[model samples]
Target: MENIDKRNRLDEAPFQYRINKDQTVFIDYEGKQVKILKGKEAEKFIKNVNAAENDKAVQLIMAKITGNFKRGNERKKR
Candidate 1:
C-alpha cells in the first residue's frame, strides 16, 4: 500500500487513498476505491453509495479527493 497526504485527520477525513501493487493510486469512498478497476467500478459506485456505511459523509468527502480521478475535460472532444 502507498501513502498519500490527507486533507483532514483520519477521523475528520472522508476519503482514503491507497496505492495498489501495480503502483496506481486509488481513492476510497463509499466502500470502493477509484483504483485500477476494469469495468463497472464507476457505475457500481454511483449505484451503491447509499448502501455504504459512511458516517462522516464519505461520499461528500470523497468528492474532494479529485487527484485520484482523471480529468476528462482536459482532453479535446473528438
Candidate 2:
C-alpha cells in the first residue's frame, strides 16, 4: 500500500536548501536531495531528480525567485 505513492504533492514548503560557491543549488524533499546547476548540467540533473525531489526543488527555487522561502528551525530556541 505504502509503495504506491512514488511522489507526493508539492503541498508544503521546501524542507531544505543549499548553494555552493559555484552557484550549484540543492533542495530536499522527502528526506532526499536534488541538485540544480549550470545550464547543461542542471538539465541532466533535473532529469535524474525524480518527480518528488523535482517538485520540492522547483518549489524552493520559485520561493527564492519570489522571496518566499524562510530559513532556520521552526522550533523555539532552548
Q: Which predicted model would earn the best TM-score?
A: 2
Q: List the residue pairs that clash in candidate 1.
A: none
Query: lDDT, candidate 2, residue 65?
Result: 40
Tens-place lDDT per residue, model 1, 4-31, is: 3243334545466554565444666534
Runs in model 1 lying further than 4 Å from the true structure: 1-11, 35-78
Looking at candidate 1, what is the lDDT of residue 34? 54
Candidate 2 local lDDT, 1-78, one digit each (tens): 123223443445534555567647565644456434566654444454444355556554433443433344455336
Which runs in model 2 stand beyond 4 Å of their true positions?
A: 1-8, 39-78
Per-residue error at 47 for model 1, in Å? 32
lDDT of 2 at 16: 57
The clash count for each model shown is 0, 0
lDDT of 2: 0.48
Q: Report how far residue 49 has shifted in candidate 2, in Å.
A: 18
User: RMSD of each candidate?
Assistant: 12.4, 10.3
